[model samples]
Structure formats: structure tokens, C-alpha cells
Target chain A: MANSKRTLAALVYNRPGVLNRVASLFRRRGFNIESIAVGRTDDPKLSRMTIVVIGDNATVEQVRKQLDKIVDVVKIIDITGDDMVSRELALVRVKATTATRAEIVQMVNIFRGAIIDVGSNTLVIEVTGDEDKIDSLLNLLRSYGIREVARTGRVAMTRGGTIGSIKAEEEAATGRQR
Target chain B: MKLSGARMLCQALINEGVDVIFGFPGGSVLPLYDVLPEFQGLRHILVRHEQGAAHAADGYARATGKVGVCLATSGPGATNLVTGIANAHLDSSPVVAITGQVARAFIGKDAFQEVDITGITLPITKHNYLIMNASDIGSVVKEAFHLARTGRPGPVLLDIPRDVFVEEAEFNYPDKVELTGYKPIHQGHPAQIKRAAELINSSECPVIIAGRGIIISDACEQLRELVEKSQIPVATTLLGMGGFPGTHVLSLGMLGMHGTAYANMAIQNSDLVICLGSRFDDRATGKVSAFAPAAKIVHVDIDAAEIGKNVRVDVPIVGDLKVVLQVLNTLVNSKSRPAWLEQIQKYQREHPLCVSSEEDKLLPQHVISQIYELTGGDATIVTGVGQNQMWCAQHFLYTRPKTLISSGGLGTMGFELPAAIGAKVGCPKETVWCIAGDGGFQMTMQELATAVQDKVAVKIAILNNGYLGMVRQWQELFYDKRYVGTPLWSPDFVKIAEAYGIPACRVKNKKDVSAAITTALSYDGSYLIDFMVEPEENVYPMVPPGASLAELMEHPDARRANASSTFTVSNV
Candidate 1:
């Protein structure tokens, strides 16, 4: 069977060794991660990490169970196939000539990409999309001599609502009340 | 000798033999962070969340059979540890969780960043303390560890206020702890032991049910000796999986939901039931009045409260399992095997609770049986919650204590991986197999790397059924199969395990089980085996909720209509 991966967005407290502890837990339990995006949450006290992992039903549940036990975690959500606005931002520097620049610009406009910076012979373009879209766009840009690419793994939210942050705050409020 | 309460607390933990602590730092605990550098020998792991810290500590405790420690600051930090603490309490794991509070002056004042951790965790922990005085800190710290590790091991919390840390106090550490309400009976009365043996000798057919207490008491050897001397067959609760090696002639595997047909049949047929170190959990006893209807019961346990808490006991002996077993073993005369064994064996052959067959595609039983076959009845197996744990108790042959690590009393789903890590750490040479369902494994999946990083070499087997299998079963049988909130669409496991540098495999058919097991067995580092099995299969021989044991719905093929109304089967 063809194998695939899933990503998880973990909202956790920003503290020392939090990443190591979470990483170590994943290593010990044997869950596999494809990519991880960690940055600041709305509250400066907490940090958010988007983890893309691969597992069958059993593997995913195992990850959920273990993650639930983590004390620093405010909330954990799996947005693998749910209806959601999922995007990753990547900056790629590709070699370009005047002849290629017009074509590149057309391709960028087609995918709604932005030309962030232009070097003498290299153009740094920023694109945001689902993982598959990014992969395809990267593939198209590869032919133009791709130099270096820095991609944000993934950041996701359910299409119509704000569930993660709200649930986390509710839990915090309930915890305080207790 | 000025110190933050957090620093002194860390020093106290170090004194208590705590080598590692899992927690998160926050506004309420910044003072401790500043002084953390001085505690050079103590290793602190900052968890991504407070809840993870609690679970890691619980995992550490279950694995090593020692007290695990977790820490967090006030409010949300303390609250995050609640689930982990509750999980430990359910599983009877020994863990210590310490959290910072707002200054004691503001305890009930609703100070900024303040939360009443003690009040919230009271029901979950064995004991909890709110430290208002710096002088009381030394004693409270000592008491927390003592309470957590003693008696029926469980989590204990110590909530330290911010001001207490900076205050000066005499460095007096009491040499002992004394609690009036906490006296645990460790030795059974001689008269009671004699009476228990007398009942055993006189009964036409007697059966023994052992639980985790045997393992906790380190009395597996004694239990084996007693079982052999008396020629009594033994059945265990889910937590008691490794308490008796299932290879013994008298071992009747697990009893109760998803239990062996023979074990439940034996319980039904016996005249006298001798229960040791095991509580009569609703899952085990199944409709109390209907359970062991013909049997006169003798219950032995260290916890007095557990006695008569579930099932009525003819005789209750409260004490340490080892001491009680030793006394009982010496008192009971060497007796011949009861004819009941023959009848149970006949039932075993007739009903035989085997889950694998050519007729079914990939079943959970097939994968479990293959793992059992490959291990050859010698490996230590750990389980997470739900059907997978019941399956191990039913199928895997447990030969010794610590062999089958599971969160039984607490039924915490994510316990297997961390427990297996601790077990491997305690016994490095022994192979530890962690078996879990999709729901259970995900609870503590974060601990996977700890196994790899520590070179724990634990093997993981995931039985994937694409749902919260256990709850889904309950919903199907009792709640009209609405199947609300149970569906699980999963990601491919192989690629994920590989990313963390662990060997991984996926098995979708029965034919692939052996190969998957072989690959996991041979891999030098940690390995993950994902076995995709049939969903919608419920654990049978179920005594419908609130129904008596006699009212069990046994064998779907032989399910009696109106089974919950009576003990007798008219047709049979």
C-alpha cells in the first residue's frame, strides 16, 4: 500500500526543554513526524507547533494518548483530512534571466505567489498553499534552477471556526476555577 | 541561605532520589528557573505542555516501578497536570506532581495566575498538600513521596506558594512519616488465613483470581507455588496479566470482558472463589449477584476499602499479598486437582476463545496471536487501554510479574509506551513489547522518542481499527450504534516512524502479520508495527452494564434471548 503522512498542530506553553520533552516522547512511543512548524501563539506565554506525522489508526491514537499526558500542552488537534484552511509559507531563490522572469511572474500570478526579493540573477519568491500545492509549485520552479528554499512546515485552522484557541482557553479557565 | 520555593523544592526532590523531572516553566515559576543551574546533577525536561509532563512521569513510574515526578507553575500549568494525575490514579502508578501557586497570602483571594490545584486534584491523588509555610515544605515533600510510593501506589500533589520558597526555615528533614488514616495492613490475621485454607480444602471446586497486587507485593513466585500446591486454576484481571505465567497448567488466562471463554466459564462453574490482590471491578465481576452464584468467596487485599466495595465477600483478609500468600501457602495442605479443572478444560475445548481463522480477514486476535507465537511465551508484553489490553490478558501467556505491564486499575489508555520504556530501563536485557489500540496509543505517543533516545529498544505494535474501538463497542451494543465521535481516519505509520529513525512496517492482511513481527523483532533500534485489523468487532462474553454476572451475553453464536434476566439458559 502507498504510505502517506499527517500533520498535527500542538498549542503548548513556551518553556525550556518543552520541545525536547515532546520530541523524546514521540521517539519513545514510536510516532513518526514528517515536518514541524513551531511559533508564537496569540498569548505570548504559550507557543504553537504544527506537527506533520504519519501513522495508521492505532499509531495516531497512540500519539493522541501520549500527547494528552503532556503537562505543558494546552491543546492538540489533528487536521489531517478535516475541512480546514491549511497553508505553509516557503521562500525559494531560483536562478532567472529576463526571458524567464516574465514566465516566472505568470506562474506566480497563476498560483497567487509573490516575488519577495530579486537578486542579480536569482529571484526569491514566496508562496503559500497546502503541502501538495507547494510541492507541485516547487517542482515547476525546480526546472528554473532552484537554489535555496526555506519552507514553513504547516499552519492550519478549521474552515469556519476558531476551535483550537477557544478550547484551550476554556480548559485553562476551567483549570483555574478548579 | 535565601532560596526560591521552587529551588528548595528541586533540592528536596533530588534528595528523594529523583534524577529527572518533566515540567514546564511559567511566570509563577521563574524564580526556580533562575536557580535551576545550581542543581547540576538533576535533569529537568521541559514538556511541550503540563499534561505531557504528568504522563511522562507516570510512564517512568509504571516502567521502573518507582515514583515518577512532574512539575509545573500556577494556574494553567497546575491544571494541565490534572489529566496526567488522574491517569496515574486510575492505573495505580506512583507519581509526584509539584506545582507553584501564587503567594500563600493570596491563596483564596483569586490572585493573578492563581489556581487551587489541591482542591481540583483531591479526588485523583492519593494525597495532596498546599504548602503555606516554608518550614513545612521539607516534611510535606517527604510525605508526598512516601504516600505516592506506599500502599496502593498513586499520584500525590504538593502545591507550593511563591512566597514560601524565599522564606528561611530550619533544614530539619524528618526521618519518617506518620499518618493515622493511612495505615496500610501488611499482614493478614493467622486465623483468617486458616479459615481461608479451610474453605479451599472443603469446597468441591475452588478457583483463584489474582490481580496486580501480586505484582506490587513481589509475590508472583509465592503465588505460583501456592497455585501448584493447591492444584487450583488461576485467572487474572487485565492488570494481573503478568502476575501468573499463562503457560502453567492451571492458569486460565484473563477473566471478564474479552476474557477467555474457559476463564469466564470456570468462574461460572466454581463452588468457591479465592480472590487475591484483585478487586471485583465491574468489568471483572460482571453483574455481581449473578457472578460466582454458587461460590463462597475469600478476598485478600492490602486496601481495606476495596473489600466489599464491589462484590460481597464471605471472608476478607486485608494485608500485603506476599505475606498473605506465604501464610496461605504454608497453611493449605497439598491437594489433588479438583474435577472442576477437567470440566473447565472441556469447556475450553468446546468454546475455545481463539480469534484467528481463515474465515475472517485481518482480526485483532490474529495479529496478537502471531506476536504471542513469535515471542514464544517468554517476552514481557505491555498494553495500552481498551480491547487491546483485554486481548493481551486473554491471549498472551504471562509468566512473571512486571512481564505484562498495563494500566489496569486506572485504565489509562496511553500508558503502554512509557511503561514499556520504564520496564526496559529496569530490565534492559529483556525484550519489551508494547501493544496498543489506536485510541490508547495516541494518548502517550510523545514518549516514543524517549525510548529511542534512551536506547530502550522497546517494540511497538499498533492494532489499527480506525475508531475509538472500545467506546465504539459500548455504543454499538448498548447505545444503538449511533457511532457518534468514534470514527478515525488515520495517516500512514511507516513513513512517520522512519522520520524519527525507527524501523516501521504496516500489515493489512493475516499473511503479513508474521513478516511484520519478524521485521520488528530484528530491528536493532526501536520499531513500530502498524497492523490494520477489522473494525466493528465488539469484545464478547459481555455482562451488559448494570446486569449481574449470571446475565452475561456469551458467545454471539449462542447468545440467549433475554440473557440479562436470568442465569440459566433454557435451550442449553
Candidate 2:
């Protein structure tokens, strides 16, 4: 099978060097991480990571199994083709002059974005949507001399259902560890 | 009761059933040494170097099937243990290494004698931790040992800061580990095992590649039963030497690079390959694509990632080898395969692994065979990597499990002597022999002092070839015999051994091998023998780099005079 884009979600314990362990695993396994976004989940003790990588099924499977080998990683699931909603937030500080200020505001409004900061020389625009929507908004604002852009890589969650690991956790309690 | 972290660490180890610890003290670990006298059950062996301590712990673990413990201070002491730790990790030896870190406040502040040992060993260790609080020491120690000894065993490390050792804390050792992702599969799925049994019953030509997992899992008897019941020819990987009885009728010795010709032949011809607890290393499976082309593989391993990591398999049984094999034994039928056994015997007769006798020259193989004959093939034989290692693997007929211990994966050179010392320390009643190359022996020969000091009565046999023999063989065969930095200069090994207060001898003739080995075997204390064997002698039945198992290069003497021109002899 040909290679395709993959997004994998993992629940991990929030501990020191957990990020380093995950990053080091990918580095040593020769797998490239396209984008990875990690933040605290509903539980304070757990962190959720949505990682986007590109590989075939076998390679992705291998990546998943190897990633699961990390002692800090609680559970992992491939959420690529699943019914999940993913969005990225990007803060673009565009160089807006007197003439281009109104034009940039109009472009942000058209992309369904908001101007969080209005500086004398630049406008800081915060956009949150799918990758394509963010990219399209960035393209229009790029001609206005964007000063800086910082993006939180894709964070995803399945829609309208619970794709959870209650069963795996229960199995672990009974010593069904893999 | 409130106790210091150092005392709690000792208590945790005692609770975990650790008998001995190999370690070296430095500035940061002074508190550990200060509190060591309070621990009555733990016997500490003071090694000459931190590397020796690590290897010794590894050897102890390999011999006893328990977690080996090593201790060292911060900075250089911790760095010195890298090679040995890597050796244990690659070979899946159960070891827990504890290193002292700089004080918690001084950490990341360029403190004196400070280094990130945990970060440095992260890749090599199964798991590692840098505990900031003294309260976490007991729990971390328990966790480290549990991780090191259970489920596809490997080395685990804990780096505790200097302050934590003397700082007082309530020591509450956790009875059970609480890692959600750290569980290992113990029982194989029943359906998968049944399918594997079905594959075994159906296949005509089957080979069992018994690996180190057999010895690690203590399933040698089960493996033998399975092999006999299924009537499959069993071949061992180098590390798997003693896992299957070498003298058994169904045994095809070792298979892979420098493997026995008959074993390699059997593997290439077999229609089914049932791998137990052994990863398909490149050395074992010459060219991955050409490895067992006609065989439908049934791989059984505790780690799930290992099943299809190296080669594709038909039935993948991911679980503990012992549990899997017990169920498999019940399912497999007792059968007879006269034709397959006859074919293997034919290969054995045609290309037997042997050295041609020379009246004057002392052959390494001859020395090894002599040792095997003298010791009754029961000694725990440990070896350094290279030609000496292969010769020991081929010549020593191991009839017991965990009898042959070598650094299989990392191929660490200075592993034998220290590991032998450790094995002797762990199994005091068993006769232990250290087979080292002269070059490798020089790397950590200082550990002979440790052996003498600790009264680890292990006999040392140095195959003094005066060169890194394996690299020389590779250069001769593939690098056009350039011999760049291969030749070695050495001191008088006998004198060196005598300087360390060890009984020593040198052998230059083949006739004296018997007496030398017999003397070493019977001697009460640690002895050393420098066998000046024929240099430039290459290990035979070698699969050259990038070649398939079928393209094996036979030794000049192994190729019979009137045999068909089927074997290729390297022009060395």
C-alpha cells in the first residue's frame, strides 16, 4: 500500500522527560513527525498528544507499537480516518500600515479570524480552524509582510462519540498488559 | 520508621532478593558508602573500574536469572559504565544500575562532578529516572528492579542526587508497580498458539531457532520437549548456545554468520521455522530477503514489537516463551521424520566444522575443544567478542542452559573476564571459565585484581592471537587484506597475571593444551593461561557481508579434497 498521512492520539502520564522519551523514540526509529501538539487533558495527571506522521499502514503500525512501548504512554489510537475534528491555532503578526490595516482586517474577517492585537505597525491575528483554512488565511496575509507566526500543531478529538480506552484500562487492571 | 534514602535503597534491594552489588565509590556516592555497613545482607564487590562493575552485574544476572545491581558515582564513574550497560541492554540482561547525581540544587548549574547520566543512558536503558526527592528513592528502586527483571528483561537505571542519599524520608516501598503501559504479555493468545501448532504439524521440513530467550525464560527443558515431540531439528543462535543441549541428536549447533555448516544448511532447506524468544538478527538471518525463503515462520516473543520487526511471519505468538511453549507442547503431536534427520546428517558429514591438525601450531579451536573435554562441557563459559567467541561457540559442547554467556548483540570486547568473575560470584559452586582474546583481555584485565580481591575463583584463558582477529578476518576477506590497525602489541600475559598474584602459564604448542586446561580446571584459586595460537586463522562457515546463508565461505580444512566444487574458500 502507498504511504498516506496519519494522525495518532496518545494519552500519557504527565511526567518529567516524557516528551523527551517520545521524541527520542521517533528520532531513533527513523520516523518523521510532521506535527505534534501536546496539552493537559480533562484529567490533571494525563496529557493528550495528537501527532501527525506520514507513513504506510505497516510503518504506522510499527510506529504505534513502538510508541506504546514507552512506559509513560498510557494508550494510543490511530485517529486518521476516524470521525474526528482537528483544528490548529496560529498567531500571525502582520506588518499592517495605515493603507493596509483596513484591508488586512477585511481579509481576517473573510477567513473567520479575529484581530487580537492592533499595534501601530502590525496587527496580531488569531486564527483557529482546519489546516487548509489556516493556510488560506495565511496566504492572503503573507503579502502584508507577516512579522512572526507561531502555530500550535494539530489537536484532535473524535466527534459525537467516546473513542476511549476504558476496556484497555480494565484489561490492565486484570494484568492483560501488552 | 524514618530512614535516610541510602538506607531505604539498601532495604529495597534486600526486599527484592538482591544478594550482591558491584560498585565503585567516588565523591558523590560517599553517603551511600557511609551507610553501606548498616546493610548486612548485601555483599558489595569493589571493582577496579565502573565498566567492570556493570559487566560483573550483567554476568551475575545472566548466571542467576536475577536482576544484577551496579553502583557508581557521578560524571566519569557513570560514563565509564556506558559500554557495559549497552552490552547488557543489547543482550537483554536483567541489570539495575544506580548512579549518584549532583545535589538537587546544583543540578543543571554546571556543578562539579556533575553529568546527566540518566539522559545519557536513556536510549540504552529500558527505563531511567532522575529522582529529585529523597522520598521517591524506595519506590524508584523497586520500580527499577521490576522493570529490569520482568518481561523481555533489560537494564534499568536510577540516578539519585547526592542530597537524597543522606536526607531523611519515610521509606514506603511499593509492593506493586503502577505503570499502565509497562505490562508484558505472559500468556500467549490460545488461538495463535493453536495456529502455530497447526503450522508445525503440517510442515515437512521444520527448524526451531532457539534463542537466548530460552535460557532467559528458563524454558530449556520445555524447548527440548517441543523439539523432540515435533521432531524438528533445533539450531541455536550464538547467544542461544546452551539453551538447547549441544550434544543432542536433534541439535544443529548454531546458525548464522560463523555458524555451523549443517545448521545453516538445515535452516536454508527447512520449510517451516519456529522461532522461540529470539529476534531474527541480521547475523543469524544472513540476508533478510534470502533468510529461510521457503519457511513459514511462527515467531514467539514476550515483546510484541519483536514478532514481525525483522522478518515477516505467518503466525505471531506474542507472549512469554515458557507459557507459550507449555501450551504448544500439549498441542504438538509426537512424530518421526527420518528423511529430514538423514538429510541433516548428510550436510554434517560433508561440511563438518573442524580444524585440521598441525603438529606444531596451537589452534584456538583445539584449545577450546580441550577445555570442553577437560571440563566435561559443564563450566559456565564466558567469552569476549570476535574469533575467540566463535571458536568457543563452535568447540565448546554446552549441554546445560545458561552455560555459555557472551555479549551477543553489542559484541562488546572487554566483557568476558568481568562477567566471568560475576558468574563465579553468583554461582560459587559452578566452575567458571573466561575465554578472552588477547586484545580484548587487555581492555579490562585490571579486573583480575577484583577477582583476586573478591576471591572469585574463575579460570581465564586468553586466546593470544595478538590482533583483533575478527576484524582481521573481515579485512582479509573483504577489505583486500589491508590490515589497517589490526595487528596488536601486547605485554607478557603470564607476567601480567603473576603481577596480579594469579597462577599463570603460557602455552605455545598444541600438545600442552590438555595439561594446561586440566591444571586450570583443578586449581583452587583464579588462574590464567596465555595460549599463543596460530594467528590470522579465520572462523569458518562464515557468511560474508551482504551474502545469503547459501553463500557460506568454508574454512580451507572444512572443504574436503574430493568433495564436489560446491564450497567457496576465501583466498586469505
Model number with the top TM-score: 2
* TM-score of each candidate structure, all chains considered together: 0.70, 0.96
Q: DockQ scores for all the models shown?
A: 0.01, 0.63
Mind giving the per-residue lDDT tens digits that candidate 2 earns over B1-572?
89988888889989999889999999889999998888889999999999999999999999888899999999999999999899999999999998999898999998998998888998899999998888888888888888898998999988989999989989988888787778898999999999999988888899999999999888998998999888999999988988988888888888999898889999999999999989999999999999989999999999888878889999999898998999999999898888988898888877777565344688888888888888888799999999999989888888888889899999999999999999999999999999999989999999999999988999999999888999999999899999999999999999999999999999998899999999988899999999999998889879997789989988776655315433322110
- Alpha-carbon lDDT, every model: 0.77, 0.88
Candidate 1 RMSD to the correct structure = 22.2
How far residue B171's Cα lies from its native spot in candidate 2, in Å, is 1.3
Candidate number with greatest DockQ? 2
TM-score of 2: 0.96
Over 4 Å off, model 2: A166-178, B357-359, B561-572
Which sections of candidate 1 miss by over 4 Å?
A: A1-178, B1-4, B33-37, B418-430, B443-457, B479-481, B499-501, B550-572
Please provide, for model 1 over A67-163, each residue's C-alpha lDDT reduced to its tens digit, 9 standing for 90 to 100.
6444456566677777767789999899999889989988988889999999888899999998898899899999999999999888876677555
Instruction: Give the lowest summed-lDDT range of ten residues in model 2 chain B.
Output: B563-572
Q: Candidate 1 - CAPRI tier?
A: incorrect
